[model samples]
Target: MKAISYARYGGPEVLALGEVRDPKVGPDSVLVKVRAAAVNPVDWKAREGHLDGLFESAFPVVPGWDVSGVVVQPGVAVSEFDVGDEVIGYVREDFLSRGTFAEYVAAPLRTLARKPGNLSYEEAAGLPLVGLTAYQVLSKVLQVKRGETVLVHAAAGGVGSMAVQLAAHLGARVIGTASEHNHDFVRGLGGEPVTYGEGLGERVRGLAPEGVDAVFDTVGGDTLRVSANLVAPEGRLVSIADVDVVTYGGRYYFVRPDPEDLRRLSELAEAGVLRVHVSETFPLHRAADAHRLSQEGRTRGKIVVVVDWDAGAEGGSQGV
Candidate 1:
């Protein structure tokens, strides 16, 4: 199978498209023919060895987790899906390797969900990781209530964009932090935009003089520290970016692969409660270029790498 992989930890330059052995399916896993894969910051961070302490690595690692695809074969123990069922997944394992940036992936049943009928493969691919993160944090962790004022950092970015919409859907008044250029985009997502930087605290305070009821921190470090001072006395704070959030009475969260959660997100998309904006897409062979774009950290939404199965067929072969 053709896929993007890296033998050693490094930059985007380390990623290369090449033919590798096909993934093996397990008893509780299904082999999915990948149509699209979404790039998240963690993909590049893992390539740079930044997550070394958290996950065990197997070299020549395929670096992607979010996928929208079709089930090609189901494992012996799996009955939830069969050949040709369209699906989306955050196909993460306990360690690196066997990822979604490939022609196919062996996704565990726990990570798989039906693709939303209203979304394209590219848009569906972009939803799993970011959507799951936002859903878990807002619905379970933060428990944002209606009429509350919620602050979301980086509202134009993937996770932040999803968070902004979900918080608003929960009936919270959302205040999102972004650059001046993205204020309109943030507002489109049902958030009141506030430009981040030196005057961030004051700007948020301007919207809710009593301080916000919850703060969703996607930008850590100084931003996280600043967010602490902007939350109301009984409010909650959660960070997906930095563990240091705990120092300020906040919870640091990590998104997990939950089929139920992914399914709910899909339902929301179908019902028009959530929408995923795909800012750009690259073919599978140009995944490195996609990585470079994501590394810039200024994308308005998600970046995706698509498998050109039609192009492959035109070249006289369909299977990679």
Candidate 2:
């Protein structure tokens, strides 16, 4: 199978296109034929060894987690899906390697969900990770309610965009932080946009004079510190970017692969309540370019890497 991988932790330059052995399927897994994969900041971070302490690494690691594809084969113990069923997944493991940036991936049933009928493979590819993060944090962690005011940082980015829409859907008045250029984009996502930087707090205060009921911090460091001062009394704060949030009476969250949650996201998409904006896409062979774009950290939405199966035939035979 052809895939993008790196033998050692490094920069985008370390990633290369090559042929590798096919993934082995477990009894509780499904072999998905790759159609598209989404690039998240975590992909580049893992490539550079930032997550070294968290996950065990396997050499020549395939660096992707979000995937939209078709089930080619189901494991012996699986009955939830069969050949030809379209699916999407946050196909992560406790260890690195066997990822979704390949011709196929052996995804555990817990990470798989049927793809939403209304979304293209590229859009669906971008949903699992960011959508799950926003859903878990807003719906479960913050418990945002109707009439409450919620502030989301980096609102034009993947998870932030999803957070804005979801928070608004829950009836919260959402205030999102973005650059001047992205204010309209943020507003389109159902958030009142506030430009971030020096006067971020004041701007948010302008929108919610009493301070916000909840703050969703996607940008950490100084931004996280500043967010603490902008939360209303008895309000909540959560950060997915920095663990230091704990010191400020906030929770630092990590998204998990939940099948039911992914299914709900799919349902939301089908119902037109949620949508993933695909800002740009690259073919699988140019995955390194995708990483570079994501690292720039200024994209309005998801960046995707598509697998061209027909192009694969000209390069080499696929495992499936």
lDDT of 2 by residue, 1-320 (tens): 88888999988888888888998999999999999999999999999999999999999899899999999999999999989999999998899988888889999999999999989999999999999999999999999999999999999999999999999999999999999999899988899998999988888888888989999999999999999999989999999999999999999999999999999999998999899999999888778889999999999899999988876522432211
lDDT of 1 by residue, 1-320 (tens): 98888999988888878877899999999999999999999999999999999999998899999999999999999999989999999999999988888999999999999999999999999999999999999999999999999999999999999999999999999999999999999999999999999988888888899999999999899999999999999999999999999999999999999999999999999999999999999888788889999999999999999999988811122212
Which residue segments of model 2 deviate by more than 4 Å? 313-320
Clashes of each: 0, 0
Please give the range of 10 consecutive residues that has the lowest summed lDDT in model 2: 311-320
TM-score of 1: 0.97
Off by over 4 Å in 1: 313-320
